[model samples]
Target: MQTNYFYRIYLLLVIFVNAGATVDSNEQSNVGVKVFGPGWDNPQLIFPSRYFFVQHFSDKRVVRVEIEGKVGENVAANRKDCRIWTQVFNETNFDFDMIIVRYKLMSDRCSNGVIIKLFDANNELLMKKETSTAIYAEECVCHNLRWNELMNCDQNSEIYNQLFADLRTFNNSKFNFENSLEEMKRRYAPYTKSYSFCHYAIVNNEIYRKCYGEYVGFAQFMDDMLISLASKTRLPNTQLIVNLGDWPLSDTRRGSIAMPVFSWCGSDETFDIVLPTYEITESVLNMQGRVSLDILSIFGRQNGLPFNKKTSKLFWRGRDSNRLRLKLVDLSKKHPKLIDAALTNFFFFRDEIEKYGPSVSYTSFTDFFNYKYQINVDGTVAAYRMPMLMAGTSLLLKPVSKYYEHFYHLLRKNVHYILVDQELDELLPILRHLIRGKQYSAKKDELPASDEEQAAIVHNMRKFVLKYLLPSHIYCYYHKAIVEYSSLLKDGEIKVSKEMQLVYTAKSKKCNCNKNDANKDEL
Candidate 1:
């Protein structure tokens, strides 16, 4: 009885001490632990992780951080993938309240922790925090909070350079955000032009959109993507002018600011920013109620035949968007054994239905991998389905075209895909060479890639898809491009125009930190 009484008294004393203790304000905020790579077998083992928390005050003060780290010297010397940077703000620092992370590369060894130093708006050191770098392996995998694949880290940087090349070239002249927007409105005004463009503003983590014409769910999908991004990290206040049409927008004669588009061509005097098509984004992520092509899903959920098991003949089935597609159908009809090309629907060539129709039955995207060769041709601008085709096990035969997507430049000829002539004059000869292993002369006499070479190309293409074309990478690319565009802005706060309808706002939602604990501690 005496021992029990003492134990009860001790327990009360411990509780009283903890209640009376002054807790740090930062500690009060629930900075959730983020795991980067695959979960460890041992529960006790710490994997690549980042502990993130933010405390938002009524005043709306901000601080941006750039978490930089390096791998071994040997790795750093030979490769551009040596260092990893979370988000890079210029040396000239201003007040930033939120943390935004972008993916780079690192080593597998976690022994050397990353060095973290906080700096104020004036570039003065405010605080220094050291954390283990072990959690940031080179093969570090993350579903969100940025993502990196097993491939070399430099690919991300290279793609970024290509995507923003036009922006950098145009940056020579100081950019006026308000004036450029007005110029875009005038240039593509609904009354003046047949096509319409949409305006979007991300102000203080909220998305606001105004479409001049029917977007056909483009604006909604984009809004969903932005919402997903903002839920993870706070974004800078900026505005975007997006072209909703199939073709790209250009003002080459007048030198207007580049507008973001789904695709572009190499031959055009175009300086437009190429963004991932909503179709591709929807295939990778959720598109709400819309019919998802869900092509990329073949990698996991869908059933697709293996490369060797697939038929040797080339296969293609799509709407008749270009004359080349119609020619392809004719060629397939002539050589039914070697090719199986058909128009699923005749829109552009409805008059020629007698020649190309009746339309063939719809083939599931997953069944695209049932053949050894898949032909990818341009539809409208660039074929948005290229990524989906590449993700499959079959070899992608891409005819040369002026049109290109954001990642089109990264695809190597005879490496990632087989490059055919623009006119496809030698397609039969090339196909015969690949199928029968017999050389045939054409416009330019070239031998078809060997069977081994074909396999290697498919392997390379799939690797590229896993490394760079995942939904996470798509989101990362969008966020990074927006940040770069925001940097070029020379104006103050962008306000919603009278025409734009209010779409979304994060102001209604509270900061994703432990508010109750933080407030209690503050009191």
Candidate 2:
């Protein structure tokens, strides 16, 4: 019984061994992928599923595969082979979106060449690829399985849709935000009121002298007159008092000495003084004579005067002409600095003329003669003829020249209309009563029958000057001249007092002396 059992066992063993060999060969033949290159252990064949390696192969049908990462170099290849077996099993059994192949260069061998070939189950070529460079020695032990291929399965995936939508929304939001900001700025700009005041003062007075002498005193006088006429007229919201060409040279001259001086004064503030460039040039010409004309011509050219245009008169002529004079007066009321600049030019011209002779060719004699003589008399040689001509022309032109005549008439009418008068004995008593805190009252349309009524009117007038007009004038003067002149004075102390005295003396001499004597003294 023992012998019979042993014989059966031996026969069974042989059958089992033969069956195993048949199964292994069948698996190798069924493989649809192959690899060939240096550094492989088995050169003739490779079992892609089993991870068999080949040392070298010449067939282009062979595919290259690279192993990466380490499990102890040689052992790493075996471990990766095991992992690949599992991946292959899963891929073959279930649906896979795609496969990703990971490769790494190997550097152990002189030429670590790799190649791979893929075939269908029927042995027909599906793909073929190769790599000339080796997997780096450090990376040769890494394991890689195809993952990127799986991403290509669906074009309309949720991840891609979300990314595109977010990108579009981000772009649109930025565009709308910018447009809203621009609309807000247009909704809030200040209201600007424009009007021109007629500035009038005696000629040759300094700013301070005029301010104290004429402007302040005139303002008081005008206030009283307005109060007297209050029953017939209403007060203006704001008054624009323009200083026509002959504005005082000083705040004191205009009677601004008692007013409080504020630091922030300019066009943006209350009062303004405008000086004409022509007036300045005229003054300069008077002082320096003909040589000043050349300086002025050069200056005019630099200032954009049309030097070559015959239709356009010479700079000084165009400037001193009646049209320009009126314009200058208008512009001076609006822009005080321009007037100051004109005056500066005149001063410089005068200085130059005084240093040079009148016969010099700074400008043509005809230009000077026309400006000084012809225009003054309207081409009449006889004094009596000129005066008669002027008077007759004035009457004739009154209707036709309404605009010019209106301003002229207004000026003459207002010239004697004192806005403020410091010298008025009546003014001092009224001011004194107000300063001493006198209580006064008045009825609508009632003339001052009592001392208290009179005091009330004076107080109101004084208050108007202090609150509105004076501040504006002082502010304008400081910005326009005081600050600059103060800086020019050595030690930064304004020589206002000394300058005032000189101005006063000059005015007195001008008023008392004859024209010829005054001219000689000025020269």
Candidate 3:
């Protein structure tokens, strides 16, 4: 009996030793942790099946999605081509800081790319952009920009360091502007004399700041009273203001809504005001308000400045999203001298057999800015390039767009952008008008004349962007808007859902503000 007991104890000890050894082996096999999150040094223990978001993001509002397949099963599914799956998450109520997704790429080569499509709570498609998963075949497949360290701007990241410096400077200084309200109104006024936009907050019965963001079509003959209220926000108030840097989730969310749109929307509970894209929806500022010029792309290359050498022909390059652009291509093919429109990525238009060309290699902003006349069109909603185009040396020509940015309200038809039809039926006629009017020539590499009407228009746009589109000015606008919106809320506080607490930061958040602040010098 004693011998039997000893034998049993020995068997149990052997099993425990084996289990410990297996765990050690698993830990030793882990790799590729520094490539992901806040830790920047932790090893990732990747198993075959489960998806893993970085620790920094996963700790916040992002949640890893669970797939109903093993590594082997996922491999089998993706063997043919890229298999895209759209999962519907409740983006409306959750104030998640970020949304990170990881999946298995059943492929031997790591160069394959995966596309993720986001949908609102109602199963409406929002936007679809592709991401590279070249490292997927190595460790894990993840959307690099989604829920990674790139989105988080903390002290650890250079972006965060810069932001912190800005915050420090902002917090250190007392709110002071050299220009009075009336002076600022005049100084920052847009090019069109009729340009009018007001932003104030309404509290109880009185008005604080007087507007959230105003849309004015006609000239504002009246001036805003510059009565300054407390700009510092208090947190205890049930009502808060939120600024969203994206368009809304769906058009269906009629009244006030709380949505989760990646990083642009802050924690649902953090702010009372939210920014996103909205056509008719009331009570939200569009992200376009905070959009900034990519300083690197604009300044890195030698561009055709105003009064410099440029082609007289109108130039435009973009993906085929609207029929108008495709029509533009068709029209341009007929008049190559006047219009220079070409497709860079033709994956979508593969089936359109009518339009085919040898892919031309061209740089982005440098190529577009080289033309005296620039064409603007909407892709999905408001095109982001319009502001940059307006800032360019080119004379603006665009279709009458139903969509508009926050700044578009102040823009006049001829002064800001020449409006055209979406069908571009009059595109050729407009080019003819330019040619006949001697505004531009239909010759390659021919620059516009100094005395041309188009040249004057180009001058106004460049001046407006250089003067009013400063990063400091934009941040002040955003900060003031938030202050006004928050104080406007009453006891009837629209409670942000729990999920709205997720931390999400917009890509332009850092750039939209003081990119050239003195605080950055300290870093």
Candidate 4:
């Protein structure tokens, strides 16, 4: 009796399948049908997919789709070739059927994440798919102006025009910039016009008492020098004054024993006068706040600034303080002139402080240096030498160095920096290296590695990072993780069930004959 019942059910299923063959040209039609299993877990659940359908109306055609998650699959079709394919799945294992309600293809191209749909004979919706995650073979269509190119380009060249053209293209193709631009402008509106600079007042005990009393007087003089220098340099837009340290202490014990210290009792009064001149005018100020004098002193110790044992001990208080000491070893090796300036500024400030008291004093030429320093005329400036000079010179040279590369590139075309033959020989291999690393992509002949092969590739990448890119410690960590995860595949870390492979395949009638001349009997 059980066998007979099973046979009857099978007969009914066959009858239903046959009944789905009827064609009603005028009636609204549904083509594909996808039936879920008992738990509605269709096979091939491990892979991703999407469903879409095309429908025809009296006046126009429409496409409808329901997406399960974020758009994963992309649809690519060539109307001229009458071919269409989903770019997501590497393989599939299910069957489905769908009916076409509309024949007209839409003229406009859909965006990256849209779903395409089709219908079955019973007007039932069918299969769906998403684009693959693998990188595409096509080159990025966007163009960017490199820092060097931006600095060196001719104002009227085709290259300049092309750069702007690419920018416009990107704006038009990728974003609605109108509203975003306004919001960005509003966010940064507050900091549009503020800038500032700092100067230090120094005092040394070695300086005469008269010089010590005149410390505030010297600070004002130094402030005036900075202002004058700014004027000569035509940096009128700058504002702000910082009186960096050596303010008057209540007792001599409060000062460093190794170096002469001058106190400025009227430091606050002198600052008030200097601050107003440096105030921002009707404009927003964007200023980097002052660095602490203590921190400045530490920086000098680390950078191998010339300091006597007594002065170094006074500044660097602990045994491990030498670890904090910076050896100009690197910079000294690269640029001797820079090192020379560093040393000169250190001693210059030290001497100025000892001779002039902790007041403003001259250091170097206007072109070479423009910072104001307070000098203690009685004592040696050597103890506070590194901190004072390093901090001051860094501020002076930073702007020039920041723009140096840009200027260098701009002048390269006008000046011959290297022989043509030497340039070609050096450039050939560098160009080849860049082309291989930056331009190459795995595509066509180079498909994604198979599960078994990926482990070895990951291992090699980790080894390369450790061996060749050793200095880049961060990349080593990242590559190690990549290798471990990739090796999991080789270790049978994942076990996939057979039911997961049963994907739904939609069915549709293939029009073997011409549509216009099809006979009713032939169909």
Candidate 5:
């Protein structure tokens, strides 16, 4: 009884330090489902074994940094135009080196600059530095490079030459970029609102957006993602969400959205880290720059196979855009026993048949989950279907990929998926061993290392994904990201900024349910 009393006191202390947040419920707000009787956040359910892991492990899936001091912090302070809050700012903590203060700029307004001051034990200002912001053209870096490559642009091509150009502009220009979705598009670039929806926080110095990266056009899909989050979230102290997708990776510089994410992709001087799109897994099909697509739903419209049972053969289907898909088709012709690869006509529009031809019948995404193995190859950019592919029953077989999306760090080679390397020479042999039950030398084979290790790889991977890869977990993580970002400000209020990503007063607006009418199920 006495220990319980002490524990309650400690819990109260932690909550009080949270500025003004109140813990009204054990479960996080609108997480759809809960496994641990109102107490389990998404990270806890997805990573039940990883207790020592810091808060918000879902957002840190693709990016993990090791720092000496405390890596994650929650802060609350007051500043010039806004109340500064560091809800969940991440920084490297070195013991003796020059303390470098790095964090994301989360605000409801366009911050001209930030002033950091270092004080000694006596509280005297030992050092102070003023920092400014950097602006870029609406496109993410990866989109431009890939776009130029497809157009067959030589060095003289506008996009090719401008690929690495100094497109960085400063706030010194004093551009009025903070306008509503329609207003910004009409005045500047027609695509401004789509690319800048999550571009910046300050819209007319009133609305505050959540965050932004390469494809600000993802704002709509992000809105739907947030809606899903809202349906299931039940936590209290929830800030009004207003996630317009109009921010940058950081204000100092711009980089590529090549794989929606990657390791060490930050530019020099500005240490802002860019995040990938969540649309990869949910099939949101629209594009602002790359030749690929943006999807609205997390999965497809069919009932998928359960994990315990699936066809033994590997299954893959898509348009022929690169050597990866072409090779898979060729190999399938040679070895029908292992792979079921084929080309599907992917005419985006019916009029295209005049220039192209009859479209090949594309397989339903729901069907892929029924097979024991699914091929994940790069098309236009990183394969956006990876999240769904891995979540399905099929064990993923991808080439050794240099490109990556947000949650790549959560996966392990030969465990979550098999890697077909550059030459891809061993693709057939590996397929034979796994699907046909043919044995290969332990040292020569990549997966199921030895004969004795037949089920270990699959079992381990299945367990890891089953725990962490749920839409509920994604929603829970999303809510936590906003909460952490909101914590940086005093009282986590949005009185100073414009609109938030998931606006707390969202009901007043007409919500468009991402038209995935075919997909009846919710994540």
Candidate 6:
């Protein structure tokens, strides 16, 4: 009995000496202790089915891992063809005949995580790991931005930084005074009846407004945004036009005025200044108004099921806005257990109702978390619910579109959400891989992400929304946009017309009125 016990103890010591601090728990092996949150320097541990192990340490920017074998050449050779965005890992040392991996690449493309692989001389897979990459958290402060940081954010900042080209154009140009309020109004006249829009002027840090066309919730949402901005900082005197239509005014006609719109697509970037969509802003503000809700509570992340408990099917239900939506329903009908999708309305294609009718009931927003993957198809323009959908714990299968919202540039495909082709040809194959960890491709290199990788992607997305999409960040963006737009005024001159009225209401006054008021808006 004593010899048997000693033999078992000797085997354990030998295993420990060979592998060095075995990390088997998935949670601890992926993300470690980083107070600001886990969007940086959290390298993953991937090994074969055998008892292989490694220990890793990371600061804000660099991660160093030690492997207990002479696998330096294998790691170096396989990393290039791993297709995880090249040139991130380097073999630092071969001391004690072991490999030391020094990972120090900082890229927005690798925001989801970095994939590190090792292959033997015969090109057989030995091990693989996916490490989380750094985002703008360390450098960019989402809550507030100093005046100077505006330009700097555009130049060096990653995720959550809004581009300010129009501001730069007007701020840098010395030749001016040719374009005035009348010229802008005349340029805007041709499209007034075609779409919904409004005009506003900020005078002495107060909101004044005039509306040509009305959309049910749009005007009120804009009022709330301006009120939030006015409460935060003193506004520069300026007048601006806003587009409240479902789609951005994409006409880049000669002499067109630069108007702020909720979304823009393709070449519209040259003419339209994009702002956060009203839908996302309204949802965030509504969540903030609740007594028990906090910044991260906007998406009801607490209600989302644990990854293992979530339903393994992809889910979607919405109006048939595009032809692709109808095709999705047809595909869902054929594979009901795999995909739960149906058109709730058929206004766009009423004639086709006979074939794809019997609309499905609308699912509650919170109930969306029951499924593992959520489908996001473009509706009218960019899907207004994208930010909210992405905030949930479930993975998103988002289709490509020409339209984009203010923060669209921050989103990385297969990082924040899985990118499905417009036609969704690879949808089923991708879903099989993510749901069951089953590879569909015949090619040896086109392997599916492991279960840990899928969960890590979801974690990265939720962290992104928590860090950058808070109510404070949205308000700060509005304030910044106003400040940058004010710089365009010639001679710093701004005038209010007779039609414009002060946009003051009980709701507006309640925000930041005084310290004594318990309802003072929280930044």
What C-alpha lDDT do the candidate models reach, one value each? 0.57, 0.23, 0.37, 0.21, 0.37, 0.52
| Candidate number that wins on TM-score, 3 or 4 | 3
The lowest-lDDT stretch of 10 consecutive residues in candidate 4 is 309-318
Backbone clash total for model 3 is: 33
- What are the RMSD figures for all models against the true structure? 19.3, 48.3, 23.0, 33.6, 20.5, 17.5
lDDT value for model 3: 0.37
User: What lDDT does model 6 reach?
Assistant: 0.52
- Per-candidate TM-scores read 0.67, 0.14, 0.42, 0.15, 0.44, 0.63
Question: In candidate 5, what residue range of length 10 has the lowest lDDT sum?
Answer: 92-101
What would the per-residue lDDT of candidate 1 be over residues 168-198, giving only the tens digit for each residue?
6557765776676677767766543456667
- The sequence of per-residue lDDT tens digits that candidate 5 reaches over residues 1-523 is 4224323333332231121111232432222111111111111111111111112211112122221111112222223222222111122110000111212223322123334333333455433333233111111011111222221123222211111121222112322222222333332234543434343232121223454334554455554444333322222232232223323223222322111111112232332222334454243212122323222121222133333345677888887555566667777777787888877754333454443333358776766756667878876446656766654445677776545544555677776667777556778777777765676554355566432243334444444433443333333434444433333323332233443442323233232222211212212
Q: What is the per-residue lDDT of model 4 for residues 294-390, given as tens digits with 9 covering 90 to 100?
A: 2112111222211111010001110111111122222223433223212222333344334322232333321121211111111120122211222
RMSD of 1: 19.3
Identify the candidate with maximal lDDT.
1
Model 6: per-residue Cα lDDT at residue 147: 25
Of 2 and 5, which scores higher on TM-score?
A: 5
The segments of candidate 5 whose C-alpha lies over 4 angstroms from its true place after superposition are 1-197, 200-217, 226-276, 280-311, 321-323, 347-359, 437-446, 449-456, 480-523
The most accurate candidate by TM-score is 1
User: Which residue ranges in model 6 land beyond 4 Å of their true spot?
Assistant: 1-160, 165-193, 214-217, 253-270, 288-295, 442-448, 505-523
| Runs with alpha carbons beyond 4 Å of true place in candidate 4 | 1-177, 182-330, 333-339, 343-523
Error of model 1, residue 48, in angstroms: 21
For 1-523, candidate 2 gives per-residue lDDT tens digits of 4224323433332222121221234333344222221112211111111122221111222233333322334665534432211111111000111121322222222123344444443466544333333222211111112111111212212222222321232232222211211221121111111111122111222222222222232232222222211211122212112222221211333332211121111121212222212222232223223233221122111211111121211122122222323333333344442121111122223443332213222444223311100112111111111111121101100111111110122221111111112222232222223223333232112223333333233223222222222111212221223222222212321223332212122232212212212222122
